[model samples]
Target: MDITPVANPALDPVQFPRLEEVEYLPVSTKYRGMRLALWGGVQLLVLAICLTPYLIYKFGGEESMATMSAWYWPVGIQAVFSLLWFLEEWKGFPRRGYAVRERDITYRTGWLFRSTTTVPFGMIQHSELSQGPVSRKLGLNHLKLFTAGGSGNLRIAGLEDDEAQALRAIIEARTRR
Candidate 1:
């Protein structure tokens, strides 16, 4: 494999210097509470969906019992998955956070498949702040950074409005410099 350095006039240089250890900043604690409530509500919905067929079979007709019995395995699978999701969400909340350094910003997330992404200031094309309906209700905003790589990019959610703005400012300053 031949790898040579070639300069592109269109692209900026200094895509991040050597990485070193930096203190990570944690996201809002409120988000964990939100996760618990959201996943609990989801499990409740799953419970309803999983049980509906059995209830109908019990009340609707005796012949449909076989059909309902067949659904038991699928229901059991979803229940187990819901349980896993609940546990992962509970355990993963604290693991999520972002760290800003001199040359780049890094974000860490996920439970089962953990990922840590570092986006250099020069590679960052833009940053966006967004709030969905649920997030707005919960008083949280997301700071999404765009770079040359399109997917699996950096997005730090569960930030308070002021904190998100501050982080955005830091990123913008880095990009500008």
Candidate 2:
């Protein structure tokens, strides 16, 4: 191998074309409400897990009242965390959306730390459509798109089941293998 420098063809590296305009389409309107409910359900489950053990110990007569009081600090911290989680999830719920174009799919997500990802169809390895117990009950499905050499690029949650199926079919038709 030679350690020689090669000459550049273009005079400047920043000669790419500039964008004329930009447009973004939002996800289904029901997505935000569905996400909020899912998060609230998770917080409730976490709350129960946090309090149940201490409640059992206190009411079951396994520990003295004074000893059982030790659970307060831990439970308090968990409650605070659950409240913060609720707030964040609520605020972040409306910030997610996606778009599918001729050659790729774009998903935009996040509130505090935001990101826009575009996955080219030719590079997509495979895709999946799934519904969790809660999402299924809510008539929602999640679409996951996997690229050849990367982790899950698109994981759009809270889509209607039939819409997810249709989108999966479209992308699957464009997938490499």
Candidate 3:
């Protein structure tokens, strides 16, 4: 048997499909509330921890004016940082979205430094659905797709319960084929 090497043909870039042109569906609006509840709880917990030391010092009958003044700076800095972080999440939520095509699924995220990940259905080994306490309370679910080989997995969060289940079913059907 003789194996002949075929001539390589150059492909035109213009013929390729444009990912930016694909219509992406935004995540559920309830995601904002879930994020606020989750982050707000976290911030409050951290603030409480930070204030514990100061509260102990003051209530322990050894209150120093210097210590009280010192506490303000650290707590103030933390408060400001948390506020900025929350704002980032709020502003960036709209930019987070996903698109499911007949052959693949794409997820785009980030506000400042954007990222887009696409996973073909043929490459998917399995998928899972998950929800955190806040997400469950908000009726939101996260769909995680695990691809074959060492390729990275993809997670599409902030989806409504029904939407996530439908998407999971679609993925399951596609993978079965």
Candidate 4:
């Protein structure tokens, strides 16, 4: 998994350095599909809500249903957004993984459309270890690295606590020096 800059003169020396070998961190694959299921359930609930007014109009009351059906466009848009989110997550989260290289880190994600993003240690401003409720139950922690950019925070999730700590130290050491 090593990406070397030894033969590529065009690559920046500070960014690529002379990588030895890149190491992939351990990640949970068991719950990879859960996200999609959860999102789908939420979307279905919304769909039911959206159709409730129409159902009422057809049976319970005409004016009442028409008043509620005013939300048709908004609810329809929400359903479409939910569907897109589900599709994106279903195709992305399962394929997500990270690799630590000598001078930078790379994350590969997405299902139908894959993306590989590399973040050099030099650009990392700081980092943190975080765990959500589910992650805490699984004893998993994520390493979140912040860069100079306002929205470029990199998160490497589903790592062991010790691994997260070690990665934090490595990133700090590399960035501070």
Clashes of 4: 1
Ranking by lDDT: 3, 1, 2, 4
How would you encode candidate 1's per-residue C-alpha lDDT over 1-177 as one tens digit per residue? 999999867744466343335567889987888778877898889888888878887788764757878878978899889878877777777788888877888888778867789888889989999998878888899999988767646888899999999999998988984
The candidate maximizing lDDT is 3
Alpha carbon lDDT at 17, candidate 2: 28
Model 2 lDDT at residue 8: 69
Residues forming the 10-long window of minimal summed lDDT in candidate 4: 17-26
CA lDDT scores, all candidates in order: 0.83, 0.75, 0.89, 0.73
- Give lDDT: candidate 1, residue 145: 94
State model 2's lDDT.
Answer: 0.75
| Per-residue lDDT of model 2, residues 74-153, tens digit only | 77897898777767666665666777777888887776667778788998888888887867777888899888788646
Candidate with more favorable, higher TM-score: 3 or 4: 3
lDDT of 3: 0.89
User: For candidate 1, which ten residues in a row score worst on lDDT?
Assistant: 11-20
For candidate 1, what is the TM-score?
A: 0.81
Show the colliding residue pairs in model 4.
91-111
Clashing pairs in 2: none
Total clashes for model 1 = 0
Best of the two (1, 3) by lDDT: 3
Over the stretch 40-149, how does candidate 4's per-residue lDDT look in tens digits? 78788988888787777766756664576686887879877987777777667756777777778887777667776788888888888988786777677878888888
